[model samples]
Target: MSSQSLEQRLLRAWYGKAAWLWLLRPLSALYCRVAARRRHAYLSGERDQWQPPVPLIVVGNITVGGTGKTPMVLWLIEFLRAQGYRVGVISRGYGAKPPHFPWMVSATDDPAVCGDEPSLLVRRCGVPLVIDPDRPAAARHLLASADVDLIISDDGLQHYALGRTVELVMLDHERGLGNARCLPEGPLREPAERLESVDLVVRNGAPGDSSNGFSMQLLPQTLINLATGERIAAVRWPGPRQVTAMAGIGNPQRFFRTLESLAFTFDTRIFPDHAHYDASILESLPGDRPVLMTEKDAVKCAGLAQVNWWYLSVEAHLSETFEAALLNLLSVPHSEKIEQE
Candidate 1:
């Protein structure tokens, strides 16, 4: 079966009342034991971890799907810069196949070569970014090449080989933890209790209650024409009521819901997370009324987009309390931070 098909089936099994998912619990248990051993190796110094001279922050999720990590990373980049710090970023570059390891990604780099999220990030903020499957190597390359005092790993919560100064975990407030199991049995990458060890837990949408973690909202900013680079306020979108919407992200439904909130009517084309696109694929859509997608998708489609193609841009907004708490945490020395951990 295709990855997309498997993903859909797992999503159904995880979030819905599918009794057969219990069969996979045995495998999940095995997976958890193995993961625990790997983590223990790092913690006990049985395996060496690369400790960077500068502080490194990891923004990631324990959930299997997207939990607004990209937006949170962008927010951190902007926030730290505003505080007069030179910031750099590193990512595992999922699905990226650059010619070499630790490749520096610029705004002009091809998304297909450096991965969609890294390309979108550099394009949006122009921050120094490096991509490699090896997270520590990427961090080292970023520091060697850029004048940065701090680094942010886009998504590497499970990469214990890379020492982190602070860790921020993101979650979809609505979905929460979906069955609260791991891997094929459910949607979590780690156990639910992993949240207790992280420096902060950020919920993507409005918190249902105080126990849900610090609230974060992905505020829509504007819509940009992929082909012409024209911008218009998202709330003031003056387009046809109906359009062809597509999202290849981890949770396409989230994108659809955002469009609905904007009063848009659309027929969606859901693709597997990180699915690549080309002109012929988009050309097959029934009509050309208008095509809208997330800015992350737009990065890959920009070169092949038609005149009517546009993508919505969003900015992450967090509460003042969260900000103050993050700043206070950053003020602590790395050694002391490790001791606390």
Candidate 2:
């Protein structure tokens, strides 16, 4: 089966609780055991971890798919900057193929080389960013090259080699834990119990149980034309109500739901997460009606986008309580945090 098909099937099996998934339970059990041991090794100091001199906060998720992490990281960047902190970001740059490891990414950097999400983050905020598979190497490089007092490791919660002062885990409130199983049997990379260990947990939507975690809403801000640098409020989209919606994200349905929330009627087109796009692929998109996509996909389609193509820009909005709690935690001395850990 094609990778897209396989991913769809797995997503369905995972969230739908398909009985066939039971067949993968043994493998999932083994995967969980190995992952637990690896984490234990890091905690026990069997593995060397690079501890940065400055504070480092990790914004990541336990699940394998998107949980609005990019938006959360972006929100943190702006929030921290507003609080007078110079922040730098590090990412694994999944699917990126830069000429060298530990490459510094700029807003002008090609999304195809440094990956879409990193490219989008740097472009959106112009924050200093470094991309490398080795989280420690990326963190060191970011510190050495940028005059940043704080570092945000984008999606590096599981990278135990990079010591962090804070961990913020994001979860899709609707999906929760998807059977609460690890890997092949479900969507989680780590076990569901891992949530208990994170410094804070933020649900991407209103939590079913208000006391469980802080709630976050991805509020649509505006829509930017890809062909030209024109911007319009998303609520005032001037195109036909029935447009083509294309999303190459871990949760395309989430994007579609956002469109629905905006009162738009759209035909859907889904791609594998981080899938690259070209003129040929887009040329086959069925209609000349406005093509709407997520900002993550827009980064890759800028040069190839048609005049009618636009991307919805959304911002993460967390409650004031969450913000005060986060700042309070950061106010705690790093030494105290380490000692507590």
Candidate 3:
């Protein structure tokens, strides 16, 4: 068993203690002030810079962590590709074991360098991905290098300096807004009311009581095996076997509950979102048991994983109107901003 108990995990996740972690809101204000000034200068044309060739559609959320942004990003990439649009992606590459600067992510790139999600995107979508601390710089690099028609930011809702044409917000069904307050006070990034202005708001998991956004539900019972490329029925996995399920995602409870609903009796191991695991940890878990995990973790653990490890993949279900709204927004040509001589 890990040092942290299941109770502690719940406390950290939905207990709303982190909602109060924003006790440093004064400090957050200072950070935003500096950020806003830099962005204002750029938007006001006082800062002369070359804009990226194609339009950028930023899919991000205000609340920190676990709003289903990655799945939505992948969904958008697939949707746009099917529409005959060439897309590229840029990310801050959070949770990489070793730090990195703006660089391209290839199928061969290690997850420790490119981060788990970016690596997964490259492997699954086979599209160009840039990992960088400076997102604007990464976007510029993608524009100059890849022959992409559209650029989608994986998660950068607060990065106003990058200049985006469209914004998508994702809300968690279980924790819409803990206490409805800001950091150190609540779980909101800006405010719940901010959703009214975004281009699209996707309620991830189940539909909550929030207004001004589209409802989205994620069905998690689908099991995928990377080892044999075979799809196994999730219903058969539930039983008295000594099974251990591991997840290092924004929301592990969702995974646990989905498995439980399928009647799987197993012990659970939860890690921080994006926690890097070495071979030693995988070797230490009890039993020759079957281990279940998320797709994001599977990509990183592929080589280290044993034959019994399986990953549950989930897809976002959006109303047809949501897709139409997205295409309608893209259909409008980007209005060129006038530059002063």
Q: Which stretches of model 2 miss by more than 4 angstroms?
A: 1-3, 207-209
Q: Write the per-residue lDDT of candidate 2 for residues 164-280, one digit (tens) a residue.
A: 888999988888888889998888899888988888999998743266789999999999999998999999977788988899898888999999999999888888999988876
Estimate every model's Cα lDDT from 0 to 1.
0.87, 0.89, 0.74
TM-score of 2: 0.97
lDDT of 3 by residue, 23-111 (tens): 66686566545555765677688875445567788888867658788888888899899999999999988865434467888888889
57-105: candidate 1 lDDT, tens digit per residue = 9999988877899999999999999998899999999999899998999
TM-score for candidate 1, please give it: 0.96
Look at candidate 1 and give me any clashing residue pairs. Answer: none
Better of 2 and 3 by lDDT: 2
Per-structure clash totals for the candidates: 0, 0, 5
RMSD of each: 1.8, 1.8, 4.1
Candidate 1 weakest lDDT stretch, 10 residues: 1-10
Specify the poorest-scoring 10-residue window by lDDT in model 3. 332-341
Clashes of 2: 0
